[model samples]
Target: MIDLDKVAHDYGGGALLSDITLRLEPGSFHFLTGPSGAGKTTFLKLCYAELVPTAGTVRLFGRDLREMRRDDVANTRRRIGVVHQDCQFLDHLTIAENVALPLAVSDRDPGAQADNLSELLDWVGLSAQARARPPELSGGERQRAALARAVMMDPEIVLADEPTGNVDWEMSLRLLQLLVELNRMGKSIVIATHDLNLIRAAKAQIAARVLRIKDRHLQLAGADL
Candidate 1:
């Protein structure tokens, strides 16, 4: 569903990523692991078309990112869901409202989707907190809510950055199970996390390719994983 061909990215300084070629096939799962400042987040941005590569090309669904118009980019983004490291949410909105924002923005009728929304909240184990505001949620609740928001649009690919970063081990595993369930339903998944143990746990449930970015390059992870 996404392809990056020898893609390299740079800011005003030097390159953050180099020769990072990858293809995320349909219904596949991948874990992106690397040290801090190793460009794991940057790679996710490239995959989701948030940042254009300075050198090579990033193609989403066979279309080159650099060639897409502003509106085109926005439309393409509808097919990809991103759970950021910070998990930004509208504090003014309730957890259910925040999770349903994507459908609302897509011009979907909220009344028609109310039942699905409730089921989704229940799926993430946040049914009781649906009416609660984001600030009232625990760290794990926020993360699960974020995941709910990301996948509400039924996106073909889901990109999560440090999904287990803030939660305890138990919560992390719970979130991981939710993701694995999504993958089983045929959504391509790419999660950028430093927690190798989480990746190991996920492997027990589904087939996932472990990838690492080191020395400015993206490569298949070694057996250490």
Candidate 2:
């Protein structure tokens, strides 16, 4: 669903990613692994249109990234769910409202999203705290809320960056379960994390392929660990 051709990205004229070419097929699962400062975030932003490549073409669905206007990029984002390590939320909004914001931002009425929101909250084990504000919820709850918000749009692709960073092991597994369920339902999943244990845990439940980023390069990681 995503195609990158000879993509090279620079920050302040310094290269972050070079000669990056890859294609992500529908319903596939991938994990991006790399050390700190290895350009994983840059790569993810390119995938989600948060940043345009400095020297190559990025095609989403079928259109070239350069051809997409800002509104087009915003619209394209609706089809791709993103869960970040730092789950941004309105401090005053309740968990339910935070999860529903994606629909609100898209101006898509979110018909029956209330019901879907409840279901997702329950799936993520956050139903009991639905009315709580972001600051009141634990780190894990906030992260799950972010996942709920991302998928609330019924996106075709789910991209998570360090999604399990701040949570305990139990909470991490719970969050992973939701992602696994989405993958089972045909959402293409790509997560960037440095946690090998979480990767191994996911491997036990789904056939997820691990891709490591090293020296500004991407390669398939060996499951031999």
Which candidate gets the maximum lDDT versus the true structure?
Answer: 1
Mark the 10 consecutive residues where model 1 has the least summed lDDT.
104-113
Question: How many steric overlaps does candidate 1 have?
Answer: 0
Over 72-152, each residue of candidate 1 has an lDDT whose tens digit, in order, gives 888888899899877899999999999998888886787887888999999999999999999999999999999999998
Report the alpha-carbon TM-score of model 1 versus the true structure: 0.97
The digit string of per-residue lDDT tens for model 2 on 1-225 reads 899899988898688788888898899998898998888888999999999999889999898999999999999999999997888788888999999888888776678566888888887778999999999988988998999988988999999999999999988888888899999999999999998998999999899989887777777898463
* Winning candidate number (TM-score): 1
**Alpha-carbon deviation at 126 in model 2, angstroms:** 1.4
Off by over 4 Å in 1: none
Root-mean-square deviation per candidate: 0.9, 1.3
**Residue pair clashes in candidate 1:** none
- TM-score of model 2 (CA atoms): 0.95
